[model samples]
Target: MRAENTQPVDRTMDIETLMRALLRDVLGLSQDRVDAFDLDTPLFGALPELDSMAVAGLLTEMEDRFAILIEDDDIDGETFETFGTLLAFAEAKAGN
Candidate 1:
């Protein structure tokens, strides 16, 4: 039998923290707003600041910050339906 090592890998930024920062920076939201974010928090339709234009900017910012490429076809209403969905997409792109 082989023994397995149990060391945790360090990630400079976790998905949730990164997502909150992204929302704050890209949407120009206050820290109070960003701090209230959660997996179930509505994003696209519910948030007044998250319009189509903001979505584009947010995606671009995410690509730059996370060093991940986001394809056109991958974007949709559902992708931004909630914070969780967006985080899932980012996490998948980051191979986390």
Candidate 2:
């Protein structure tokens, strides 16, 4: 007989904080810049650092940090349209 190991996931982790840190680290944005982002803050086209190439790295980091899998069809322009949209996408993918 073997005992099963069980541990509850920490759902209370603040996704917004994680996102702010991620954006700062991945995109090399200043802490002040990321901290100032509101729900309506534009991302992809509005930020010079968040170009098409950076999107790939951002997606990869999101997957690793959030422990969520993102498929090719799962993303579109709307996903990165704004800070709110990106947060919504992350919350959905993380099952939050």
Best by lDDT: 2
What is the lDDT for 60 in model 2? 99
What C-alpha lDDT does candidate 1 achieve relative to the native structure? 0.87
Worst 10 residues of 2 by lDDT: 4-13
lDDT of 2 by residue, 2-94 (tens): 987674455434788888899999999999999999999999899999998899999999999999999999999899999989988998898
Cα distance off (Å), candidate 1, residue 75? 1.4
Q: lDDT by residue for model 1 over 6-64, one digit each (tens)?
A: 64354524767888999999999999998988789999989999999999999999999
Model 2 residue 29 CA deviation in Å? 0.4
Clashes of each: 0, 0
C-alpha lDDT values of all predictions: 0.87, 0.90
| Candidate 2 Cα errors over 4 Å, as ranges | 1-13
TM-score, candidate 1, is 0.85
